[model samples]
Target: MKSSTIRTFTTVHTWTGLLAGFALFIAFYAGAITMFHDPIDTWALPKQELADARVMDKAGAMMADIVAKHPAARESIGVTYAAGHPSHEVAAYWMEKNGTWMTQAIDDAGAHDAEDHEHGLADFVYELHYDLGIPEIGIYLMGIVSVIYGVALLTGVLIHLPNLVRELFALRPGHNLKRLWQDAHNVIGILSLPFHIIFAVTGALLCLTLVALMAFNVAIFDGKLMSAFERMTSALPDTAAMTAAGPGADAKTNVPMLPPAELGAIARKAALGAGATNFDPDYMRYVHYGQPGAAAEVRGTSEKTLGEYGMVALDASTGRIINMQLTGARDANHATYSAIFGLHFGTFGSLSLRWLYFILGLAGAFLFYSGNLLYIETRRKRRNAEQPMKVRAMATATVGVCIGTCLAISVTFIANHLAPYFGAEPTLVVQPVCFITFFAAVAWTFWRRPAKAAVDLLWATAVASVLVGVLDMALHGDRLVRTLAEGRYDVLGVDLVAMAMGVGFGWLAVATRRRAVEGDPCSVWAARSPRVTATTTPAHDG
Candidate 1:
């Protein structure tokens, strides 16, 4: 790139990064933990110790009983037969536009099986990471930010290239403030280039799918394309235009539907027949149950990454599969959509792939952190406090927001466990509290001493969050001992992690305190700022 272009890119990268750094930091941190979503789920909702339970009765028999009991659910689907809790099995949409669904888990005689379902903490954490602990919309917004972030990344690289050769791993320790930040930012960016690119492309596709469709429409379809796309993607039973009927048949608005277990079995068999490797019917659907041609569909995923992967929908009466083409299936539209989904969610790979993404994500977060520090530090020597008021204001806001994000996340974990007992829904209460508190912290610290605020907040986060874990251990009931002695790793695993977090927090508190004691404004980048009035490091306090 030309020198001018590089400078332009650098400016874009720095500003964009600074703007999004705080949100991205929390996102990346939570995302890293979400990598082990399943394990975490298991840890929070430990297995019921009833794995050996048997499916006593046949699916068909139980399904019969369900239908007989709930006669109105006659147009119902299949059955799910399991003695113990199993991965969701059975497809059943509970729409009563036509009829009610009464799918029952059954033993051999077709009676209902007893099982329990509980929302677990791991799922909460998963939500927190992606959605800023918000509801569904958070995911889409994050995706939008990711797209803007990609633009910033490209620009940043362009600007940094001019000095890339001059400062490869360049950490000028003493008397050089800017060099420390510049080195930190540049190195992490280069190291995680591949990861950043992957996220950028995927994130763009996710957030801009609507835009993409619009472009395609104006360019090729002339604003009319849904019909053709649907035709290519799936086999819709009725494509013909129906003439207006003189009068609709006297219709019952609500009718009882088939039993869930039998509906699941039918859906599972169809899915298996459709060549899905693991045909487990989960979350069944029943549309217009008890009405003429009522449909029952089962949706699921298979091991195949880019092949036929969705569940098969079976005609509840005839047991004929109605539809099965998923995005993974080979078709122009489906393949493209599947790839987009895989890229956005990191679903294309397993735990290892997720870990790689997580590490790169954190590196990306670090990139922004360093970018802010670089901006402030570069002006430190040349510009006094009377430097452009706007520049000073921007730097203060950046530091407060960026550091404040770290503190907020620390608060999230603490609030999660405590909010429940405070007569509040933990996820609802904790997420907003952490975010609002964080915003308040940033605004308050802007005019007050920024450096001191940053240090104090970090310490507070370390203490508050770390203490949550300690409290959990101290208050454990008999369940804790039982879990440990039984060699069940779920509960034990989380306990261990909590303990580790406490230790990590304590360590950070120590390190930052030492930096303050030693008169350094920045803890990690000690050479940049002169020490505080104190001579000793936090390590050597009274």
Candidate 2:
């Protein structure tokens, strides 16, 4: 690329990254934790004493009773049969009137109280990743962010192309702070380029689905988009077929739906026959229940496959298999699509792959953070007694949003452990607590010097992370011990990871404080002092 072209691409990269970096940071960090979604879910919920066999045996009866009591559930109900380790009890889920999902756990006696369930810890984290916890609009906004992120990635590569290979592993943490940050940013960005690209594309696809559907409906499909999508994705079987016995047969008016146990068996058999061997159904939906036209679709995951989740539909009246969509048996188009989804979510491969994804996710978060730092550093007016207002503003926002988001997430975990003691709903308070802490951190950043604010936030995050593990121990020590005794490490893993994060954050705080006091005084990250001057270091060139 020519020098002028490089400058233009550099400008593009800077603005696009600045615009989308903060949100992407949150998404990446939260997404890192979400890779262990099931473990976090286990950590949040009360200990499950019932064995998987016990839960599975009674699940059918419990679900039948649940549907009998709450007919609304007949429309759609999710049954969680098993989760990786420290297994959750068999549970039934349905959406309440206010749109809150209600879950009822089937106990040892094959009974449950509808009001007893609470949301999982990882749910909020997952929500923050894709939607930032804001409803309808948040997802759309993130979709736009993803598009910008993709453009930024492209421009970033174009700008770095000349030195891409020569400086691939370059890192000089020396007097030139801007160079250090630039090198770090470029290194991580290049190393994780493929992962970032996958995230950008998959995120856009997932979040932009609604908008794309609407656009295609009017622009290309001529109102036939729904049918086209169904054909492409191989959606559930048609409900109309449930009423017809065969071609030219009279439609049945009403018929009772099959019990959960029977439907589960049929779906399981069909899914296995369709090439999904370890098919464990986690979600199901019913249409026209207790009528002749009733049908059920069971969605599940299979082990040792790139296509993790698949579905099977069955006739609810006779427990007969209607249709199957196993990822393992999917065609080239569907398989490729499903593979992208699986890779983005880190659902394929073994535990090792998941760990790799987790590390890369946190690295991606740091890439954005370092990009912000580099932006501020490059723009700093080092000669002045104070940095430019915009540089200061950017610094404050970056510190407040990035560190604050980590602090807020830690607070949510603390809330998760503490909520039950006060008879408070964790789900209701998690988001509020997170937002409050986040905004308070931002406000604090405005009040304090940028360097001081960054250090303070780091320390606060460290403390909160440690406290989360401490509170979990205090609240659920017995359960943790019991799980360990049973050779299940779900809850134990979360607690250990929390403490490890605390240690890591605490180390960062100490390092950051030292750097502020002793490192390049001309840099924005250094504490302001009379000795600092622009002439101390040469101006950074893009």
Candidate 3:
């Protein structure tokens, strides 16, 4: 490439990265934690009682009771089976006309209210990953950010192509801080290039689905794309469409319905016959329950497949398989969509793959962090004078949004542990607690100098993380011992991980404090005055 071309690419890379770095940092950091979503939920929430032999009967009763109380819910309602995980409560879900869902556990003592489904720690962390804790517009905003991130990735590769081989592993951490940061950023970015690209592509596609659908409808489908698209993705016949024309569609019937266990067994057999190696049905949605036209859609996860999830639809009244779309039997379009989710979430492989993804996610977060550091270092004032306003602003933002996010999430974990003691539901307070801690930490970051705030927040995060482990032990010691005796490790893993993160944060705090106080007198990270003696050595440029 020409010198001007390289410069153009470099500028593009820099601007795009700066534009998307903070959001990507939050996404990656939270996303890493979400890799262990089930385990984390298990660790933070109280366990549900083990299901009895009559659990299937209870599920069936719950479904019937829901439709009995609210006839309108006969249109569509879903019930999730526990599948041996107490955290996976057997719950019923129905959407209200106003576009909100109501959930009720099968074990509830009385009639359930129209309360919205309560999200656990894993789901909330995932919201931070994709939505940045914002609802409605956040996903779309992140879609645009993902586009810019893709551009940054391309331009970055272009700008570094010439020197990539030579500087790929260069890590000179001497007097040239800029050189050190640059080398570290390059190393991580290059190593995680594929992972970043996968996220960029899939994230944009997932988040911008509506936009793409609109564009495609106008451009190629002549405005008839949605129906076809829906059919392609969901092989099952639309219940609303069926209800309009099928037998007994206009009225409810008094016919006895098949047992929930039998429906699940039929779905499981269908999935296995359709080539899923192993299928565990966890969710089933009923449409027109107790009627001749009733249908049930059972969805489950499959092991050892590109499509980690598969669905089997059945006639609810007679237990006849109406449609089957398992991992191996899916059509091209449905398989493609399922594969996207599997690849994006590392759900197609073993637990080890999830762990690998977790490590990569944390590394990706660090990659963006180091990119910001490189930007600040590259712009640092060299003459032992006050730093530029833009430089300071970037430093403040880097500390606030990045490190503050860490502290906020750690505090959120603490809040999760503490909520039960006050007789509050953790699910109800998780969102409020996360948002509050996040905004407060950001305000604190802006209130103090960037370097000082970074160290302070790091320590806070360390303390908060340690407290998560401490509280888990202090509050649930007896339960933890009992669980361990039974060979359950999820809760133990979470506690250990929390304490480990605390140690990491503590080390970072000490290191940051040392650098702010003693590393460089003229840098933005320095706590001392910018003035230097005449005989001071000049900083080296890489």
Best by lDDT: 3
User: In model 1, what is the error at residue 92, expressed in angstroms?
Assistant: 8.9
What is candidate 2's local distance difference test score? 0.79
Preferred candidate (lDDT higher): 2 or 3: 3
Q: Each prediction's TM-score against the native?
A: 0.71, 0.89, 0.94
**What residue runs in model 3 are displaced by over 4 Å at the alpha carbon?**
51-56, 108-111, 238-241, 252-255, 530-542
Error of 2 at 526 (Å): 3.4
TM-score of 2: 0.89
lDDT of 1 by residue, 1-542 (tens): 77777667767776777666666776766666666665554433222233222342243344445444554444334433232232222211121334433334433233443322222355555665566665547767777778778888787666666677776677665435466666777777776776778767776666566566677988999877655654454433333211111123123433344544556667666656655566544345444344445555555555435432354555545566666655334556666766666665566576567667666666666676676667766554241223345545655676577667666656665666566568766536555766687787787666555555656666666666566556555555455677578675555555565556556656756765554456433332232344443333333111
Candidate 3 per-residue lDDT over residues 1-542, each given as its tens digit: 89999889988899999999999999999999999888887777655566554665678877888888777677788888776666776778887677777887765453355486778777899899998988789999999999999999999988888888898888878877788888889998988899889999989988998889989999999988887776677656875676764565555565466767779899898777876788898888887777666788888888667778888888887888888888767778888899888888889888889889999999999988999998888887776547789998999999999988998898888888788789988888889988888888888988888988999999999999988888889888987898899999888888998899999999999999998877777778887665665555545432
Better of 1 and 2 by lDDT: 2
What does the lDDT read for residue 241 in candidate 3? Answer: 71
Residue 482 in model 2: shift from native, Å?
1.8
lDDT of each: 0.55, 0.79, 0.83
Local accuracy of candidate 2 as per-residue lDDT tens digits, 145-166: 9999999999998988888898
Please estimate how well model 3 matches the true structure, expressed as its whole-model Cα lDDT: 0.83
